[model samples]
Target chain A: MEQSFDDDEGVRWMLAWKAGDEAAFDRLVERYSPQVYALLTRFLGPRDNREDLVQEVFLRLLRNRDRYEPSARFSTFLYRIVFNLAVNHTQRVIQRAEGSLHGRHGDEDGEQLAELADDRASAPFESLEQDDVVRAVRSAIASLPENQRMALILAKYEELPYAEIAGVLGSSEKAVKSLIHRARETLRERLAPFLKEELA
Target chain B: MNLECAAFRRELQHSLENHAERSGAPLRDLLWHRHLHGCLDCRELLSAEEALEALLSSLPNPKLPPGLAQRVLARLSRPAGAQAELDALLELDRPESARPGLAGRVLAHLAEERALARRNPQPVRDLDVLLELARPVEIPVGLAERVKNRTRASTGTRGVLLRWRWMAAAALLALLLGVYAYYPRNPQPSPMVAMQDQPDPALLENLLLLEEWELLQGGDLEVLLSTLPAEDEYLLDLGAEGATEQGGQPKKG
Candidate 1:
């Protein structure tokens, strides 16, 4: 069974925090930080910057906590923040690469492998074969168009409802469904060989 | 598979994700079962889709790094005192006599009570009576103390004088009520006199003049003034301005 945190608990923490109870605010962060971190890692991929991005996401939450209402689910609200931050970070990296004549011939590969190990520890695989499959899936996911990738990540990984995915993507639910359908078809085509082997 | 059979298989796969249960939908279930039995190609496709869904669902939940909670708590703790200061500022911003919406109104009432309690710090007899009189309303959390502090600051020395004035007003109200209880009931005044007793003549005249005027001023005036009977066309005598009638009737003096 999934260990679900009561939404009311976060609301209560907010109420208590508003009432000048500091401990309640701490408890609120403790309750949600892991989920937020997991979501960020899923979106941004296993990288050294994941922890820093996670911190930034929480810092953003702290800065804007007063604005949080119980309208959307807390996870939805949190995921939206993580999604935007990850997208912005990706855009920045792209921009940096475009500006520089010499690509930052940094040790990104080594760092990425270490981060991958850490990420895999949290997202346990049945075997090394499964890990390779996951890595291949991640690469295929990255190759998708940005909107399609975001839709796929939110739907397949985050398990957000179609409506919430629409909200995050600023598209209609019908459009979001089409994007996911297209994305899934692309993944199926791309991973056909691996999947066929697995089935065999 | 035939194009028709492939399309049917695709629809079944889509419905499996979108719909809650496929059990009782006769045509759909029959199509699905038939496709699975007769078509190896469709069967493999369906199995692949299910496996993909299961794999997606099986992604593990990650945990936050050590001490992350402590860091968040530390940041949140610093904000408390700052929030109190901001609360005071916000209280100063709000109107004094105006009732805030549900949350704001409740907080204001609580703030007033908290102030009173702070001033005495001693147990007062019939504190519950005072509380009932005050009518503590539910406020948005964290607003009351802010409102109270600001109210206290702004009122200054006049706070005590305002309390005395309130007591005096209460006493006068009680006196009026006692006199009203013992006094004999007078007969209801005539409608004209009651209308006259209303302070504004412009309001009364506006009430009487219906139709074009009422249409411009909107609302259910017909319902409001339904008791007044409609009069037949009154003379629009131009005699006051010394004009003669074309019909040759003598002008009334």
Candidate 2:
């Protein structure tokens, strides 16, 4: 599906799924799976476990189908669960690096976000072998303190507004902007070689 | 880079990041503030940013691993098959992954505070009563007369209600915090943007730093809102201070 169902439609589907309309649950999966898969890949790198994590997100959705509240946007609830799952999986390796020392106050709320390519054996990102610009950008993104990276993905790729991004990350909009700003600055620094070369 | 260049770079970045600065602000505004006319490096950086942004956004989403949705649906369909496993998998939620509504609790706290405050509101003692407490006469009669007259002039015109300006401000501040707490949760853009117009939050924020909220009374919210600094100024202020106050760190309630 080129453009999946909108958030309202997703809510309707959730309501239907809650009403025991099994097809509604399928529609919900069809609408959100690519997005969930893409977001998980962005956050955790291209690991096989992401497939399982994506499944778990849906399973949680099935379990919490009754927990869906119409007052909030369907996407907000879904993304909160998604990001939370991503954060849980990330803290093990990401927090081990330099970000642990330069910890932001928001770290405790979200997953301890900061990942490493230079660290221990399980360098999941090593699987992503794109070309130069792709490689450099991904590296810079991966190197970002996890919170900044998550904020950047939601803002830059997901195109979620700052406010929604903040909610999903369990942060304030101002902090979301700060996260993106810092993320951008770091990316510029890390990808300086490409940017400077492109400028020349 | 030298400190001056660093400062220039910072200013330039702010100008670029800020939509108002990029679209409407003239170079003369920055040039007047700093000697930016001679710098070639930042000039190139400023221009090259568009290309950089294109490059940044150009990175595509990875192709989804095949059958990702089919697999999710497969599990959803076969509830009986994965029942025990799904039940066990649900237990993986560690404590940090939980996103309880901190705002709901803080807002409840604020409500309890407001209720308690209302039940035992600030005593509305008269300013004259307060002033009378300090009236032991040890001064020369002339000096005492001068002091008393000035004191009367200051207090007589403002009346006693202004003494409760702190309470009014606190009430308004609580109202403002409630409105602010609504922003993150409000998914719609127009409503949240409209909420910004109700009262000048920045102006009200300064109220918290006061011992007595003398600038505003209960009736003055509309007056203050009407006289607020321009929207561009607010955005510029947020952009400038965001890095330090709002953006710098996570301030947990």
Candidate 3:
């Protein structure tokens, strides 16, 4: 099937599916799968189970196909779903780790093990040097407070306009700009040695 | 550089990130102009920051494994049986547009019947006995068979009573409505009636004249009494005694 770039293809496919055409649904899956996969991979990275997460995203898409309204840009709607699920999964993992630690009677040493688990789970990007740098940057990003990290991710990776970023994060454009500025300041500080070499 | 002027360089860093390109001149020109004026450290720092931004932007995005798309597609493809079930369910819920004309005609007929029934009116029968019987009656095996006979027997009486009661109710309502419509009501006064109720000009002038006469009499009496000389008072006393002797009436001068 030939993919369309008309931007309304998602809406067209949805309407056609509602009208009982199966082929249009197939086309929809083909068109949006890669975009959804790309976003999930960015969120989960290489080492964390990408396939399960991607499959989970698509399964949710199937379950929620009826709710897919065409008012927003399809990519925005799709990525919003992916982002929410990924954040939820991350939160669950964090909660599980906390539970384990609490059950073990205040083992401070478990903190290192948890960090190691995180490092190992996020290890696939370590192969390429640039990937390694991006990973480092991502880790630094993940270390940021949730609001700032969300603001940065939507602005940088999603290439969303400040207004759109504001909409996603439930903030104003000025606040979004402030968040990105603060994020960049933090990133610059962390990557100063690397940045200095790059500049040289 | 003075700290006050150096503070602008901090703002310049933020501005450079937010506004990457200078509006008119090349960024280098703007930077060099600022540099020439003062603040060598900031000039160097700005240049370094710009160089780093360029390098970061030039880095290529990493390509994913080739199987990524295939893997995603494979996961999304539902099994044939599941797909068929979903299709069937969707079909069941699909909005039906057939027979609208026939349905509309039937609805119109029912609505017309209802309107006619309302206009002709209906009687209220005493169903209390029937209701009491219904409440206590146990359904026997032969009850259904007796229902048809009972219905036929009651139909004539029901019809006559319903019609008579309807007519009586309508007549009573009409009488009440007529009384409400034609009964005498208190007449509200208009602006013209209020104008007519006001005092007449002749009456108002007479009242004013009476008030002025009383005031004049009071004032004149006070002035005459006040201006009388002491000898005149004694003469008045003598006149009083003389008047008493002469049948108690003073003669007018």
lDDT of 1 by residue, B1-253 (tens): 7986768667865554443344535342564686667778777776676555545544455545677656544432334465467567667776877543333333434444443454335464236325423423688887989899779966887766676887888999999999999887988788877654543456545544543343522224324433333321122232211122123442333
lDDT score, candidate 2, position A144: 77
Which RMSD values do the candidates have, in order? 26.8, 38.8, 24.4
What do the candidate models score in CA lDDT, each in turn?
0.58, 0.61, 0.56
Sorted by DockQ (best first), the order is 2, 3, 1
**Pairs in clash, predicted candidate 3:** none
Instruction: Please rank every candidate by lDDT, starting with the best.
Output: 2, 1, 3
Docking class of 2: incorrect
Candidate 1 clash pair list = B103-B140, B106-B137, B107-B139
TM-score for chain A in each prediction? 0.75, 0.75, 0.73
Error of 1 at A188 (Å): 1.0
**Tens digits of lDDT, candidate 2, A1-65:** 34333457877888887765768878888899898889888776665557766776775675465
Q: Deviation in angstroms for A179 in model 1?
A: 1.5
Top DockQ model: 2
State the iRMSD of every prediction, in order shown.
7.2, 8.8, 11.5
State candidate 1's DockQ.
Answer: 0.13
Measured by lDDT, the strongest candidate is: 2
